[model samples]
Target: MKRNIVIATLTAAALATGGTVAAFAAGDDETATQRQSSAGTQVVADRDDADDRADDVNDDADDADDREDDADDRTAVATGDVDVTAAEAIAAALKSVPGTAVSADLDDEDDSGKVVWDVDVLGGDTWHSITIDPATGKVLGSHTEQEDDTAQVRAALKGSSVTAAEAAQAAAAKGAVTSVDLDDDGGSRAWDVETRATGKADQDWQVDLNSGKVTTDRSDDDED
Candidate 1:
């Protein structure tokens, strides 16, 4: 009977140790699962942060492009206003002349804050002229002559070499002379005239009023 009791006690002790080992294994598995979950959350957060940074960079680029476009628009508007003022002045000057209709275009080459225009004066025909000013929209001087009336002016241009009326008439045949004035440029006689001419193309002419000669001839390219 004593032997039987000893065997029963040993079996009970063995069962208790096995139960303790099972509990420890369950705890370790739970800890490992928690660690894996934490690592996954960190990876997701990092990806979100990178996406936000990329969006910010794109926004900055768009803002810079918008500023540049605004600046270009402002510059164009300013240039257009100056051109309008110049055209009005030439039109006013031509109105003083009989049987002539005058129109003006801006000259981009004369950007020295100087008002320069390609003036077209049409009467019996067309005459082109260039008008210049020291200040924007202010007419300082002008040169103009005839284009189509070449034959008449060439014929009349003979005799005495230079006559204001004859030269004026030649200029008129091509178009019309809106303004004609004579002046001395550094002791050299200079004639300043404004005219508009027409051919296969419409153009403006600037004539030396003193010499009864054409100075500069400009076409539609000077307009916009």
Candidate 2:
């Protein structure tokens, strides 16, 4: 029961790291956190009940999605001089904040009038959103969000043998990475990568975060 809750929490954290949070909120909302906390408690209470556990996990995931959506809406557009690639941006973010580089993208801010790499990292119990100068690879700014599931995220990442950079390299074989998110695959955690290769269709790959294995590979063009 405890293990299940930990897994579920880590999974939610990974999925909620990227732009997905924008559809819901810009950052961690109090209501979303409360709801997730309640769901986690419910999971433990209903450990013996499979249906209840499943429902709780689903509810938790829904709340997480809402938060992620909110974040996505708040994320700025990627634009400007992009000399540094997404992979390089991830490297810079990881150096600044040691943990999982869950997501990264080019962001063009009208106010700043500068192109920046917006990267989200999960380190220990804190979620860090860092801004990097795409041209110089300099960390321009950053913010942190501490949530109830921080420990779970830390555990999941520390337990994983594969680093985010390693996962990106494995996925890079597909194409230039657009985004990389730590994701849960039916209790197994992996890095979800989207790549764009010149003269080829975009692709999605899943690399096992625990074993540095490419578990799933497919082309996005096929869906079209």
Candidate 3:
């Protein structure tokens, strides 16, 4: 009889997360019955505990969805002068605060008429927006942007042999590299760079992070 009671209690706990209750009852003489009767037996569950467990499961699922949304985010197309490469500006920003650069833009501010390197860096779950002077590599100012999940970003960059700085450096041979962004839409991470030169159309280049090879991307051309 005690054995049956213990089994019923354990069954209740297992069903608590599903918001269901199992009802089980048996007399001492009922144990003499065939084991087939246990098949339909129900076990009691704590209703309140079941609701709480269900809520916790929902919260976990929502958190996972939020992280996935952040993982596929894209940055704006940024332009800058070739006098200071994107790699140099990023290097300058990291010197001010140690972190990884996820995205960067060379902006010619319309209101201030000043060109600066605006970089987004990720450190743990925190994000920082840093500005640097393109000409002198001076730290202009910086502030906390927001929080982000670094799990996906870290995994994507694990196998990348070429850093963003190296990709920009390799693109210099093609033209004045303006922007260098990390891209992994094709299942592998690569640095996408933009460049412009006199009497030539603005060109987009991709630096294979694994092989360190520079190639022209015609996708942008197809859009035009």
Candidate 4:
């Protein structure tokens, strides 16, 4: 009876040891699987972050390229076969002419492919209409009007009783006097003066030469 009891106790001990070993092995396998899953998740997240960064860099590069393209387009539009700097240079050159006021007008082309600037100038007795080439700064054409005479212009002055000499002096104070003419309208004599000012806005004067009185003075306004 004693031997059987000892044998039964040993058998129970062996069974318990085997069960513990099996449980430990199963736990180890589960832990290893969980670790592999976590590592895989981290790798995928890293890859996604890298891709996002790369996309941002590509977007920035694309934006830079677009800006460069826009700048190139603007440069092309501003400058053609005719140099814009040259046009400005021509305008500057015209400002140096004596008894010539020069103003820039809308640039237009003629049949000869020349760009012209319409300038208004005041001479002793008339308003001189002038056209100049923007590229060459050369006078293309100029004309004087009889109605722009200074003596007649002085008669038209705003003041009630200003002399022709005073009107002429006033106009001259503002610009360069090119010529002065006398016109006799029956008993009334008028003086016509033409002048040129800087920046070319019109400054001619007309006055009564006989009485030294201004009969008509049109300085600021130009008829032609």
RMSD of 3: 17.3
Cα lDDT tens digits for candidate 1, 1-224: 99999999988888888878888888888989999999999999999999999999999988876565433323433445343333354554364333232344434334343334455454444454546431354545544566654344333323424434344455555543433433332333343445533232222444453456665444335665
Worst 10 residues of 2 by lDDT: 71-80
- Local lDDT at 106 for model 2: 55
Clashes of each: 21, 23, 6, 40
lDDT of 2 by residue, 1-224 (tens): 99999999999888887558674574558678888999999987777688777889999998986665433322322232456767899899889999777677654543344456788888766799999887788999889976566555565676678766778778777766666776653465677877665556546788887677775554344566
Error of 4 at 117 (Å): 26
Per-residue lDDT, model 1, residue 224, is 56
Best by TM-score: 3
Of models 1 and 3, which has the larger TM-score? 3
Off by over 4 Å in 3: 1-82, 147-149, 222-224
| lDDT value, candidate 4, whole model | 0.51
TM-score of each: 0.32, 0.53, 0.58, 0.34
Each candidate: RMSD: 19.5, 28.2, 17.3, 21.4
> For residues 57-112, what per-residue lDDT tens digits would candidate 4 score against the true structure?
99999898666653332333244422322224324334543332322332333423
